[model samples]
Every structure is written in structure tokens, then in C-alpha cells.
Target chain A: MLDAAIVLANFVVIPALSYGSLLALGALGVTLVYAVLRFANFAHGDTMSVATMMAIYCTWWLQSLGIDFIRPLPTALLAIPFAALGTVGLLLVIDRLVYRHYRQAKAPPITLVIVSVGVMLILHGLSRMIIGVDEQRFFDGGRFIVSAGEFKEWSGLKEGLAIKSTQVIAIVSAVTLMAYLFYFLQRTRTGKAMRAFADNEELALLSGIRPQKIVTSCWILVAVLAAVSGTVYGLDKVYKPFTYFQLLLPIFAAAVVGGMGSPVGAILGGYLIAFSEIGLTYAFKRVAGHLLPPSWVPDGLLQLISTDYKFAVSFTILVAVLLLRPTGLFRGQAS
Target chain B: MSGRDRVYFVLCLLLIIGVGIFQSWNVALTMINFALISAILSLGLNIQWGFGGLFNVGIMGFVALGGLAVVVVSAPPVEEAWRAGGWRVLSALFVAVLAIGGSLFVWKRWRPKKYGAVSLVVFLTMAFVLYRFLFDPAVLAIEKVNPALSGFLGGFNLPVLLAWPVGGLLAAAAAMMIGHIALGLRSDYLAIATLAIAEVLVAILKHEEWLTRGVKNVTGLPRPVPYEVDLQQSIWFQEWASQLGIDGIEASSLTVKLCYMVLLIIVLALIFTLCQRALNSPWGRMMRAIRDNERAASVMGKDVKRRHLQIFVLGSAVFGIAGAMMTTLDGQFIPSSYQPLRFTFLIWIMVIVGGSGNNWGAVLGGLLIWFLWIQVEPIGLATIDFLTKPLHPTSPLRVHLIDSAAHMRYVMMGLFLLLVLRFRPQGLIPER
Candidate 1:
């Protein structure tokens, strides 16, 4: 039974939690954009790519400067603030260049969505041109909190748990940032103004909220989340622009499943999707062995589906939610 | 068409003629073939976005389905693989479908009460067990047969041309299924749903090696046009080539390409004329009315969602047909090559740049954008080289700039899209 618990925790729970946090961060940005901009930001993933690329360059520069102040942690953690500021500037530029025209013109949501696709293409190309289309691993400092062999020796168990330092950092940082975001949204005056604007633009404007300030703040927050999430995801896995693009589906699924504009819903939806995907792909034979009698144990590996179809899990859940609860699992601002 | 439309067509003609004059007839023919296919895809998307105001970012999925139809309709069946597990696999799918259908029927009939729910659960459990019992072993058996070569059931061994309409029908069916679920909601929901479905469809094609051979790729699909090699061996062809002072090989390849071009032209002309008539008819006017004011149309009892579904399916069918033709042109089914950037967004660019809500605009946009999409690399390369001439010959920056010239199309095309969206939202050809 302990072996089964260890196996599940090692394979399914740890990875899902790590991945879920990354997705939650991504989904938060998407949801915020959906709330304020009134359109799905198709470029959201590519923005993440651009921000991650910026973080990567920052890491390289810091390394060149011989600045490994955070030795136990990846230098990327130190570089993130710089990357966040850079990303914020880039997003503001993009907003001014492309989106402001549409927003000011009072275009429909679909037109803005298409406009975002245009932004996506440009950002996608810029990232590729600057960085090239190859996977880059930038992890430095500690590789793991507990190596597999060390874990086995310490626990005296057959199943070994290799806990990654990056995973822990991703989760902790994400939670910290999320806490701060919640506090900001609930307690800060600017946050209230932004929410009011998102809830009803006319009402907020009539109430003397500066529309420009709220929009700018929303973009800045989105930029920070995009940078942090992209950096965390890159550190956990590796940075690949194409892989970042593929994240659009899951991140958007999280946003829509959680309710497109709801922060809390986005976080929960991320965990739900991550758990479903990992659980579905993981072989359950060992767990079954611990739970079932000898005669009842199955012969096959008992994996629900192939790993190649892991992406389908989130899609299936999204469709189910759309059918059963069109507003998403949460009652968001938009129905 | 207006004088401005005529001018755009003339400009496109000049560009094609210039390609033929400078880059050889073969290159021009290749450009024309692909541009025509792009035109078809643009027309399809135009129906959805232009006429109906539906946002579909899933053109890649429909196109892949169409490509899949070509393989399934044209490739000859592998008898050995079929003998092993094809019948069993078919039965398993039938059982699974029946299980879902039966449960749905029961739920609808019994109003979600206790007995009805119990029966549904019991029936589903049994059906699922039976399906797995039959399916798993059969799939394993089928996959085991000549794993390096033909491992699964292939196709109907029909003429490749017949796959075109079949592809359209397949895509239409898929569109209907996706549209039924996605429509009647906020506009972005359809976009998100279609985006997810497109990825799933491509995933299905990529992973179901039993169906599409996965990444191994089903190549050398039977062609509707005569083979260049066959044409090269013919005596009359050699005589014609010599009379035209062209090499036998060049002439034969050109001849083959022309044959493919003629077929493509016929298909495009048919589609274009059909679109023209449809847009001018009362049906088209009603579509425009609904697009212009959905709330008003709904208030008038126009069955807005159903009409959107109709246009969605029609548009997807057109995409499917083009996809089939694209595979036919390439003579392969490469599922992994279907990128949303190329198949979906580039077509979107064409629709917007050419002018949505207009057939001629789609054609013109396809031709002009395809020409630029192909030529942009060379142009970018030369411009970058000239701009960087002040740098040392072996400077890393210059080398990198030249090496990445191919990527400039994305930036250029993106800027082009943005500029057009801002300045000329109606596109080059405005709707009459």
C-alpha cells in the first residue's frame, strides 16, 4: 500500500501539481485578457514564448556577468524581474501598435480575436528569428531536491521519488504570485477599478475610473503572469517555441473550463486538466497490485490510453463542460 | 466584376506571366496549382467569415480530414492486414457507437429517472467491456502484420479523383458535428471549440497509425493526372517536345503539370462561379442580413444558429475538397505537416487581404499572397544582404540575418495583415 502511494505520488501527483501551477499562471493571463479585452487572446501563448525568450537571454547575460547569487536556485529566478519589466514594455508596445486601434474603434470581439491572431504570427516569427527553433535548456544550480537513488536509500522503499527543485520552485512561486494577485484584486483600489471596468466598462467609466489606467494595469499584470509562467514552464521542461504554441490549447482549456474570466476557476481548472491528463496516461498496475487481491490483479499495464493522446484529455473535459455548463464550471462575468 | 476587380485580375495575370518568363514554366505551373488550391480554401473560409460572420480557426482539421479521405478512398486495401483483424475492428467501433447511442436514447426516453439511469449505466458498462475485449486484441493483431510495411486496412482502391467529393462530404460531416456543439453560444466559444477540435483531428490522424500510418506517411498516392515518366516514354510526346525545342523530360513534366493545372482550373472555376451566383441570390442577401444584424435576424425568426451551421458545414466541405486536391498534387498523406499557421491563418490572411464577402477577392488574394509567400524569402535575403553590406563579410550578425531570411514572411505577412485590417478592412476588393 505504501509502495502504491509512493508510485502515485511520484508519477502522477507531483508532476500534475507542477504542471497545473504552470497552466494556472498561463490561464490567469488568458482569463484576464478575456475579461478586459472581451476576446480570447490567441497570441497569449506566443507572448509567453517571447517572455520566456527574454528570460532566457537575461539568464545568459547574468551568467556572463558571473552573477550566480542564487546558487541553489536557477539564475532564472533572479532574471525574472528584469524579464517581467521587459515583457511589460513589449506588451505595452504591442497594445499601442495593434490592439489600441481596434479597442478604440469599438470593434466586435471576433474582429479583435482575429487581430490577436495577427499579433500571434508576428510574435511567433520574431521569437523564432531571434532564438531559432530548437529546444534550449537553461536550468542551473541544483537538479533535484531528492534524487531517486537517494530517496530509495533514505526511505528503504522499492518505489523511489525524485523530487525536482524546479518543480518545487514553480509551485511555490506560482502560489506566492497567485496569493499576491488575489490580495491585489480584493484589497487594492486599482484592482477594484480594473474589475469594475471588466465587469461593465460604461459603469466603471461613469464612476470615474480612468479606462486607460485600468487597461494599462491589466496589460501589465498579464505581462507579468506571462513572463513568470513561461519562465517556470521553461525551467520545469525546456524552452521550445513550438511547444509554447501547443500550450495554447491547454491554457485556453483551463481558462474556458474554469470560466473564461474567473481567476479562481482558472486555477482549479488547471489542476483538473493536469490530473486527468496525467492519471489517464499513467499505468496503474502497481497501484492496483497494492489495492486488489492477488487473484483480482490485472495482467495488463492497465493504462487508460496512450500518452500520445494525452492532449485529448483536456479537450474531452472541455467539451463535456461546454455541453453541461456552457458558462464553464464557474459562473463567470460573461455567460 | 468592377473595373478595379478587373485590374486586380490583370495584375495577377501579369505576375504569373512574369514567373513563367523568369523562373521557367515548371515553377509557374507549381505556383498556379498551389495558388488555385489556396483560392479554394480562401473561398471556403470566406463563406464562413465573409458571408456568415462565423469565426472558424479549424481549417487545418477539415483539410486533414479531406487528406485522410484521399488515402482511405484511393489506396488499395491490404488483404493480409484486413484478414487479420479488420472485421473485428469494425465491429468494435460499431458496438461502441451503438452503446453511446443506446444510452443516449434511454436517457432521453426515461427522463433521467432511476431505472433509466441504471439501465444506461449497465448497458454502457457491458458495451464498453465487449468493445475492449474485441478491439484491443484485434488492434494488436492488425498492428503486428507486416509492421514495417502494411500493418492495417488501407482503402477502397477507387480512382483518386473520386476522393475529392468524398473528402468534402467527410469534412461537411465533421463540421456539422463540431458546429452543432459550438454554435448558438458567444462567438469566441466557437473559435475556441473549433481550435480544440482541429488539434484533436490532427492528433487522431497523427497517432492512429492504423488509419494514416502515423508519421511513416502514406506516399505515392495514385494520381488523377498521367505520370511524367509515362509521358516521357511516349513517342508523340518526344516529337512535340522536339518541335517546341524543349527537352523531353522538361516537356513531359510540364505536360503533366498542365494536366493537373487544367483539372484544378476547372474545379476552381466551378467553385468561383457557384459562389458568385450564391452571393447574388436572395439566399446570399439573407445571409448578409443575418451577418449584419444577428439579433434582428433572430427576432425575425430566421433560425440564425441553424443557418450558421449550414454555412459552417458548407465552408468546411470546400476546405476538405481543397485538402484532397492538395494531397493529390503532392501524392502523399503527411499528417504531421498540417500546421495551423500555413493551412489556417495564411488562408485567413488571403481572405482578409483579398477581400472577404467576394469570390474574385479570394482568388486574387490567393494568387498575390501565394506569390509573395513564395518570393518573400528571396526578396528578404537580397534586401538584408544589401542592408548589411557595411558589416564585415563574415560578421555573425550578417550571417544570422541572411540565414533567417525565410522567417521574414511571417513578419511581413503579419504586418501586411495588420496594415490591411487597419486601413482597408474591406480588403482590396470591396463587396458590391
Candidate 2:
């Protein structure tokens, strides 16, 4: 029982938690934009990629400067604020130069979605140009919070649970960020105005809420989320521009599945997708070997789906949700 | 067409001639061939988005399916692999389908209402287990046959020309399934859904080695035109080349290309005329009306969803035809080449720039954007070289700029799309 528990915890639970947190951050940004801006913001993934690239560069600079204080922790956390600022400034400028005119014209949401696709292409090009389309591994710090060898020695167990430092950081920071976001939304004047604007733009406008200010604040929050999530994910995995672009689908699925305009729903949807994806593709041979008697052990690896079909899992869930509940699990505003 | 439209057409001609003069005639002909394919793709998109106002972004999937059809319909079958496990594979697939159909029947007609969902799930699980029992061994058997070269089941050995319409049928069938599930979505949701579906389609093609040879790629598929090597070997071709004062190799290759262009032109002309006639007909007007005001059209008794599905399938069929032509031209089917940016959004940009809701505009956009897409990198590299002429031969900035020039096409395309949307949302050729 302990062996099976350890194996499941190490392989399935830990990985899913870290991945879910990263997805939650990404989905939050996507949902926020959909709520306030009234378009899908297809460029959200590239936005994260660009911001993470900035953070990566900053981390390199900090490392070159011989910053030893963050030697035990990944340096990307320190660089995230700077990256977020840059992203916020860039998004504001984009809004001013491109999206503002369309917003003023009150173009249909579909047109904005198409326009976002254009922005997505431009951002994709810029990120690739800056990063050179090579996979970069910038992780520097403690490799693991609880090393498997140490855990085995300490627990006197055959199965050992290894937890990575990045996983811990991702989960802790994601929780803190969500807590702060919820607090702000529930307690602050600006957050209330933003929520009001998202709920009913016309009513909010009539009530004297400044649309531009709410829009600006929303972009700022989304930028912060994009930077933090992208950096954490990069630290945990590796930074590849195309991977981030591919991540757009699962993140969008998370947002839509959770309910596009709901923050709480986004968080829930993120974990749901992350767990299902990991759970479905994972071969349960090791866990089964531990749990089942030797006489009853199965010959084949007991994976429900292969790892190559990971994207298919997400897509199938998305299509099923869209078909059965167009408004989403949380009953977001219907189109 | 109006006088302005005539001028636009003349300018397009001049641009092609300019390519011929500046580059070689061979390069120009190659561009024209691909431009013709892009035009067909854009016309399909125009019908869906411009005429029907249905946002479909899975163009890559349909196009890839078209390429797949070429392999399936034209490539010679691996007889040994077939003999190994083909019948078993077919039987497994039949059982799986029957299981699904049986489950559905139970859900719809079973007397025990409360146990329907549970029974359906149970049946599906048993079916899945049964499927794996029958299917896995066959797959292993087939894949193990000469694992280096023909490890999987191959296609019917037939004339490649027939793949074109077959590709259309395959794409149309897939589109029907996709459209049925996704047509009711809002525009943005629809876009994401289609994009996801396209990715899934590509994923299947990439992983299903038995169906597509997966990423190993199926090369040397039979072509609609004579092989350049064969043409070069013929005495009649050599005589023709000598008469034209060109070398045998160049003449043969050019002849093959020209043949492809002629075939492509026939397909393009047929589709163009059909699209134009449809756009001018009452059916076309009704589609446009639905697009312009869905609520109003619905009130007036139009089956908006059904119409959207129709246009969606038709557009996908066009993409499939173009995809088959593309594979035929290259004499290969490479699944990895069907990227979302190159195959899907680039076509969208063409449709938007050419002028949606207008077939001629779509054709023009297809031609123009394709030319630009191909030429922009070279132009960027040249501009960078000219600007950095004063720098040292090994200057880092010069090297970096040159290296980055490959990405300039994407940036330029994005900027051009945004500028056009902002300044002239109606596009270069607005609908009449």
C-alpha cells in the first residue's frame, strides 16, 4: 500500500499539481481577457512566451552579475516582476496602437479574434527572433526538495517519493497569487470596477466606471499572470517558443471548460485538464506491479492512452464540453 | 468586372512578369503553380467566411487529408504487410464500430431507462478490451514486416489523378463531422474548436503509421505529369528542347511544371466559375443575408445552421482538392509539412487581403500573398545586406540580422494584416 501510494504520489500527483498551477495561471489570464475585452485573445500564449523570454534574459543577466543570494532558489522569481512590467507596457502599447481603434469602432468580437490571430503571428515571430527557436534550460538552484534516495533512507521504504523544488515553488506561488487576486477582487474598488465592467459593460459605464482604466488594470493583471506562469513553467520544464504556442489549446480549453469569464472556474478547469491529461496518458504498470499480487500481474502496460495522444485527450474533453454545455461548466455568459 | 478590377488584374500580371524577368521563368512558373493552389484554398475560405460568415480554421487538417488521399489512392500496397495482418486489422475495426453502434442502439431503445448509461459504459469498456485483444497483435505483426522500409499497410495502386476528387470526398466527410459538432458555436469559440480539431487530425496522421506511414513520409507517389527524368530520356523531348534552344534537363523540368500548371488551371477555373455563379445566385444572396444578419435571417425562415454546415463542408472540400494537387505536384506526401501557419492562417490572410465575399478577390489575394510569403525572406535578407555593407565581413550585427531575416515574413505578414484590417477592413477588392 505504501509503495503504491508513493509511486502514485511521485508520478501522478506531484507532476499534476505543478502543471495544474502553471495552467491555472495561464487560464486565468485568458479568462480575464475574455471577460473584460470580449475576445478570446489568441495571442495570450505568445504573450506569455515573450514575457518569459524577457524573464529568462534577465535571469541570465542576474547570473552573470554573480548574484549568490538566490543561489538556493531559481532566479526567475526575482526577474518576474521586471518581466511583468515589460509585458504590461508592451500590451498597453499594443492596445493603444491596434486594439483601441477596433474597440472604439465596436467591431464584432469575431473581428477582434481575427485581429488577435494577426497579433499572435507577430508575437510568435518576435519571440522566435529573440530566442532563436532553440530550447533553453535556465534552471539553477536546488534540484529537488525531497530527494528520492533521502526519502527511501528516511522512510525505510522500497518506493521513494521525489519532489522537485520547482514543483514546490510553482504550487506555493500559484496559490499565493490566486489568494491575492481573489482578495483584491472581493475587497478593492478597482477590482470591483473591473468585475462590474466584465459582468455588464453598459451597466458599468452607466454607473460611472471608467472603461479605459478597467481595461488597463485588466491588462496589467493578465501580464503579471502571463509572466509568472510562463517563467514557472519554463523553470519546471524547458523554454521552447513552439511549446508555449501549443499550450494555447489546453489553456483555452481550461478557460472555456471552467467557464470563460470566471476566475474560480479557470483555476478548477486548469487542474481538471492537467490531472486528466497526465492521468490518462500515464502507464500504470509500476503502480499496478506494486498493488497487485504477482500471480495476477498483467503482461501489458496498462495505459489508457499513449503519451503521443495527450493532445487528443484535451481535444476530446474540449469537444465533449462544447457539445454538451456550450456555456461551460460554470455557466458563463452565453454568446 | 469594373475598370478598377481590370487594373488590379493587369497589375497582378505585371508582377508575375516582373518575377519572370527578375528571377527566372522557372521560378515564376513554380510560383504561379503554388499561387494557383493557394487561390483555390482561399476561394474555399471565402465561401465559408465571406459568403456564409462561418469561421473555419481547420484548413490544415482538410489539406492534410487531401494529401493522405493521394497516398491512399495512388501508392502501391505493401503486399506482404497486407498478408500479415490486414484482415485481422479490418475485423478489429469492424468489431469496434459494431460495438459503438450497438451501445448507441441500447441507449436509444433499451427498456431499462435507469440502466442505460451504465449499460452503455459497460458495453463500451468490454468492446474496448475486445478491440485491443484483436487489434494490438495485428498491428505488431504488420509493423514488424520489414520494419525499415514498408512496415505498415500501404495504399491502393491506382492512377494518382483520381485522388483529387477522392481527397475532396474524404475532407468533406471529416468536415461534416466537425461542422455538426462545432457550427453552433460563437465565432471565437468556433475558431478555437476548429483549431483544436485540426491539431487532433494532424496528430492522428502523425501517429497512425499504418494509415499514413506517419512522419517517415510517403515519397515517390505517382504523379499526374510525366517524370522529368523520363521526359529528359525521350528523343521527342530532346528535339523539343533543342528546337526551343534550351537544355534537355531544364526543358524537361519546365515541361513537367507546365503540365502541372495546366492541370491546376483547369481545377481552378472550374471552381472559380462555380463560386462566381453561386455568389451571384439567389442561394448566394440568401447566404450573404444570413451572414449579415443571422437573427433577421432566422426570423425570415432560413436554416442558418444547416447553411453554415453546407458552406463549411464545401470549403473543406476545396481545401482537400488543393491539398491533393499540392501532393501530386511534389510527388510526395509529408505529413509534417502541413503546419497551421503555412497551411491555415496564411490562407486566411490571403482571403482577408484578397477581399472576402468576392471570388476574384480571393484568387488575387491567394496569388499576391503567396508571392509575398515566398519572396519576403529574400527581400529582407537583401535589405539587411545592403544596409550592413559598411560592416566588417564577420560583424555580429550583420550576421544576426541575416540570420533573423528568415522570420521577417511572419512579422511582415502580421503587420500587413493589421494595417489592412485597420485602414480598409473591406479588403483590396470589396464585395459588390
Candidate 3:
């Protein structure tokens, strides 16, 4: 039982938690934009990519400047604030130049989505240009929080548990950010104004909530979330522009599943999607072998679906949720 | 056509001719063929969005289905592989379908609330288990046959030209299924749904080796026109080339391309004429009315949902036909090549840029955008090189600038799209 538990925790639980944290952060950004803007920001993924790329660049620059601290953690954590600030500036500029006119014109949501797609393409290209299309690894500190051998020696268990420092950092930072966000939304005047505007634009406007301030504040929060999430995701996995673009689907799924405009729902949806994707695709042969009697051991790898079909799992869940409950599990804004 | 329309048309033609003059004719013709395909795709999208006001973003999936149709219709069947486990595989698929249908039927027909739900779940689980039990063995058996040349079941050997309409039918079938499920969704949700479906379709195409030969690709597809090599070898071809004062190799290849051009032109002309007729007809007017105000139209008994479904299927069929034509032109069907950027969004850009509610505008947009999409990279590279000439050849900045130029087309395309959306949301030729 202990061995099986160890196997499950190592393969499914840890990875899912880290991935869920990353996705929750992304989904929060997406959900926030959807709530405040009344349009799906299709460029959200690329925006994250740009933020992460900025963080990577900042990390490289900091490293070049011989700035080193906190030996076990990546230098990227230190650079995230600068990256978030840069992203905030960039997004505000984009909002002014591209989205502001559409918002003022009261263009239909679909048009805004298309415009966001155009933004996605531009940011996608810009990121590729700035940081060529090659995969970049920026993590420099301690590789593991708990090495498998160390765990084995300490626990005297047949199965060893390995945890990465990045995973711990990702989960901790994401929790901290989410906590701050909830606090802001629940307590702050500006946050309440933003929420009110999202809930009812006309009513909020009549109530003296400035649209421009809310929009600016929304972009600022989204920038911070996107930068932190992108950087953390890159640190956990590997930074690739294409990977971020692909991450869009799972993030969208998480946001939609959690209830598009609900922050709490987005967090829940992120873990749901992350677990389902990882759990469904992972072969259970090893765990089964450990858990089952030799006489009943399966012949095959016991994976429900191939890893190549990981995206399909998320898509299937998304489609199922959309078909069954358009408003999502958390019952966000009704279409 | 109006004077401005004529000018736009001429300008587009001039652009193609410019390519012919500045670049080689072969390159220009290649661009024209692809441009023609893009126009068809744009027309399809225009039908859905302009005529019906439906946002269908799954163009890539329908296009992939069309490519798959070519593979299914033209490729010679692998008898040994089929004999190995094809029957079993077909049975497994039938069972899977029946399982879904059966579970759905039970849910709909059964009145007992608890039992109905429980039975439905049980039936589905059993069906899935049965499907895997049968499917896994059959797939292994079939895949093990040759494993090198033909490990999977191939298509019926038929005239490659037949694949075009067949592809349309396949795409229409897929569109019907997708439309039924997604049409009722809100506009934004529908877009996301369609996008997901397209991604799923491409994912299946990429991974399902038995069906599409996966990423190994199906090359050397039979072509309607004579092979260039074969044409070059013939004495009649040599004499024709000498008369034209062109090299044999160029003449043969050009002749084959011209043949493809003729076929493509016929299809494009047919679709264009039909689309124009449809736009002028009462059906078109009713569709426009429905699009402009769905609530009003629905109150007037327009059957808005049904109409949306009709236009969606029709538009998707057109995409399928174009997909088939593209595969035929390439003489290869590479599943990996069907990307959202190339097959889906690019066409959306064309539709938006050309003119949403205008067929002629769609055609113009298709041609103009495609030409730019192809040319922008080279132009960007040249500009970068020229600007960086003052810098040392080995300068990192110069190298980076030159390298970055390759990506400028995407940025330029995005900027163009935004610029068009901002200044002229109705596009180059606004709807009359």
C-alpha cells in the first residue's frame, strides 16, 4: 500500500499539483480578462509566452551582471517582478493601441476575439523574433528539493519520492498570488469597482466606477499573474513559444470548467484539468503491478489513452462540460 | 462590377503578374494555385460568417477531413493488412458507434430516473471495455503486417479527381455532427468549441497512423495530370517545348501545372458562380435578414438555428473541396502540415481583409493576402539585409536582425489584420 501510494504520489500527485498551479495562474488571468472585458482574450497564451520570455531575458541579464542569491531557487523568481512590470507596460500599450478602440466602439465580443487572435499572432511572432524558436532552460539553482535516493535512505521505503525545487516554488507562489488576488477582490475598493463593472458595466458606470481605471488595474493584475505563471511554468517544464501556445487549450479548458469569470472556479478547474490530463494519459502498469496479485497482473501498459492524446483528453473534458453545462461547473456568467 | 471593384480585381491580377515578372513563372503559378485554394476557403468562411453570422473557427479540421478523403479515395488498398484485421477493426468501430447510439437511446427512451442513469453508465462502460478488447488486438494484427511499406489499411484505388467531391461529402458529414452539437452555443463559445474540434481532428490525424499513415505521410498520390517526368520523356512534349521556345523540363512541368490550373479554375468558377447566385437569391436575402437580427428573424419564423446549420455545412463542404485540391496539387497528404495558422486563421484573415459580405471581396482578399503571406518573408529579409549592410558581416546585431526578419511576416500580417479591423472593419470592399 505504501509502495503504491508512493508511486501514485510521485507520478500523478506532484506533477499535477505543479501543473495545476501553473494552469490556475493562467486561468485566473484569462478569467479576470473575460470578466472585466466581456470578451475572451485569445491572445492570453501568447501574452503569457511574452511575459515568460521577458522573465527569461531578465534572468539571463541578471546572471550576466553576476547577481546570484538563494542558491536553491532559480534566479527567475527574482526577475519575475521586473518581467511582470514590463508585461504590464506592454499590455497597457496594446490596450491603448488595439483593444481600446474596439472597447469604445462597443464592437461585438466575437470581433474582439478575432482582434485578440491578431494580437496573439503579433505577440507570437515578436516572442519568436526576440528569443528565437529554440527551447530555453533557465533554472539554475538546486535541482531537487528531495532526491529519490535521499528519500529512500530516510524513509526506508521500496519506492522513493522525488520533488523538484521548482515545483515547491511554483505551488507556494501561485497560492500566495491567488490569496492576494482573492483578498484584493473581496476587500479593496478598486477591486470591488472592477468586479462591479464586470458584473454590470452600465450600473457600475452609473455608480461612479471609472472604466479606464478598472481596465488599467485589470491589465496590471493580469500582467503580474501571466508573468509569474509563465515563469513558473517555464521553470517547472521548459520554455518554448510553441508550448505556451499549446498551453492555451488546457488553460481555456480550466477557465471554462471552473466557470469563466470566477476566480475560485478557475483554480478548481485548473486542478481538475491538470489531473484528468495527466491521470488519463499516464500508464498505470507500474502501480498496477505493485498493487495487484501476480496472477491478475495485466499484460499491457494499462494507459487509458496515449500521451500523444493528452490534448484530446482536455478537449474531450471541455466539450463534455460545454455540452452538459454551458455555464460551467461553478456557474459563472450565463451566456 | 463597379469601377472600384474592377480596379481592385486588376490590382490583384497585376500583383500576380508582378510575381511572374520578378520571380519565375513557376513560382507565380504555384502562388496562383494556392491563392485559388485560399479564395475557396475564404468563400466558405464568408458564407458561414457573412451570410449566416456563424463563427466557425474549425476550418482546419474540415480541411484535414478533405485531405483524408483524398487518401481514402485515391491510395491503393493494402490487401494483406486489410485481410489481417480489417474486418475485425471495422466490427470494432461498428460496436463503438452502436454503443454510443445505444446509450443515447436508453437515456432518451428509459423513464425510470435512477435505473436509466445507472443503466446508461453501465452500458457505456461495457461498450468501452468491449471496444478496447476487440480494437487493441485487431490494431496490433493489422499494424504488424508489413510495418515498413503498408502497415495500415489504405484507400480504394480510384480516379484522384473523384476525391475532391468525396472530400466535400466527408467534410459535410463532419460539419453536420459539429454543427448539431455546437450551433446552439453562444457566439464566443461556438468559436472556442469549433477551435477545440479542429484541434482534436488534427490531433487524431497526426496520431492515428492506421488511418492517415500518421506523420510518415502519404506521398506520390496519383494525379489527374500526366507526370512531368513522363511528359518530358515523350517526343510530342519535346516538339511542343521547341515550338514554345522553352526548355523541355520547364515546358513539361509548366504544362502539368497549367493542367492543374485549368481544373482548379473550373472548380473555382463553378463555386464562385453558385455563391454569387446564392447571394442574389431570396434565400440569400433571408439569410442576411437572419444574420442582421437573429431575434427578429426567429420571431418571424426564420428557423435561425436550421439556417445556421445549413450554411455551416455548405461552407465546410467548400473547405473540404479546397483541401482535396491542395492535396492533389501537392501530390502528397502530410497530416502534420495542417496547422491552425496556415489552414484556419490565415483563411479567416483573408475573409476579413477581402470583404465579409462580398463574394468578390473574399476572392480578392484570398488572392491579395496569400500573395502577401508568401512574399512578405523575402521582402522582410531583403529589407533587413539592406539596412544592416553598414554593420560588419559577423556582427551579432546584424545576424540577429536578419534572423528575426524571417518572423516579420507574422507580425506584419497581424498588424495588417488589426489595421484593417480598426480603419475599415467592413474590409476592402464593404457590402453593398
TM-score of chain B of each: 0.96, 0.97, 0.98
Compared with the true structure, the alpha-carbon lDDT of candidate 3 equals 0.92
CA RMSD per model (angstroms): 1.4, 1.3, 1.0
Docking outcome class, model 3: high
Q: What is the lDDT of residue B246 in candidate 1?
A: 94
Q: Per-residue lDDT tens digits of candidate 1, residues B1-432?
A: 899789989988898899899878899999999999999999999999889999898999999999999999999998887889999999999999898888889889985576887887788889878888898888888878898887767899999999999999999999999988888767888788888889899999998877788898898799998898998888988899999999999998999889999999999999988988999998898899999999999898898988999999999999999999999999999999999889999999999999999888888898889988998888899999999999998999999998888788888888889999999999999787
> Using DockQ as the measure, which candidate wins?
3
CA shift of B352, model 1, Å: 1.0
How many pairs collide in each candidate, listed in order?
0, 0, 0
lDDT of 1 by residue, A1-335 (tens): 89889889999999999999999999999999988888999999999999999999999999999999789999999889999999999999999989999999999888899899899989988888888889999999999999989989998998899899999998998999999999989899999988888889999999999988888999999999999999999999999988998999999999889999999999999889999999999999989988889899988888878898899889988878887788888877555
What interface-residue Cα RMSD does candidate 1 give after superposition? 1.2
Worst 10-residue lDDT window for candidate 2 chain B reads B109-118
- Runs of candidate 2 with Cα error greater than 4 angstroms are B110-112
The CAPRI quality class of candidate 2 comes to high
Candidate 1 residue spans exceeding 4 A from truth? B115-122
Considering only N, C-alpha and C atoms within 3 Å, which residue pairs clash in candidate 2? none
Q: Could you arrange the candidates by TM-score from highest to lowest?
A: 3, 2, 1
Cα miss at B382, model 2 (Å)?
Answer: 0.6
